[model samples]
Target: MDKIHLKGCRFYGYHGAFVEEQTLGQIFVIDCTLLVDLEKAAQSDDLVDTVHYGLVFETIKKQVEQHKYKLIERLAGAICQDIFQEFPAVQAITIKISKQNPPINGHYDAVGIELERQRP
Candidate 1:
């Protein structure tokens, strides 16, 4: 299957387990890989033949910025669900969400989780 890679999508959201995190909010970085067949799109050379990444970005933005979740796992799930629902051309998705400064007492670049989901 062909792939569409949308990486380094950053958003400010209030999603965390801690009170300070939900109150102050933080930056969340997302990387998404959309699995789809691009043969028709390649032949047609038309935007309609493939998924509109700009709209996909908007969908992700709404989920990240407008809603609050206690866990990044749930957030990841929501994103996958929305993407699959909004785009029928997408067969599967792999999403990674990173929290830059998680409320943890440790020295790390970032803490994150990755999820892969397929259409049923």
Candidate 2:
């Protein structure tokens, strides 16, 4: 299947189990791959036949900003659901949510979760 990929989309938000982490916030990077048919868009050369990347980006951003989750896993799942519901043409999606410089024991730049989902 063909997909439109949005890689390394970054945002600063409050999300964590720790109080400092939530209050201070941190950088989050999201990467998404959306699977959909492109035949109609390709053949007709019409924007409507294809996914609107801007709209998708905004939707993701809006959700991320509105809600805070302790787990990146949950965030990614929510995003997947939002995308699937908002855009029925999408047959599948892969989402990765990352937190930079998390307060871990060792030196680690980031931690993340990746999830893949398909239309039912």
Highest TM-score scorer: 1
Query: Each prediction's Cα lDDT score?
Result: 0.96, 0.87
lDDT tens per residue, model 2, 60-88:
88778878888778778888889989988
lDDT, model 1: 0.96
* lDDT at position 42, candidate 2: 89
Q: Give the TM-score of candidate 2.
A: 0.94
Tens-place lDDT digits, model 1, residues 1-120: 999999999999999999999999999999999999999999999999999999999999999999999999999999999999999999999999999999999899999999999987
lDDT of 2 at 5: 91
Off by over 4 Å in 1: none
- Whole-model lDDT for model 2 versus the true structure? 0.87
lDDT score, candidate 2, position 65: 84
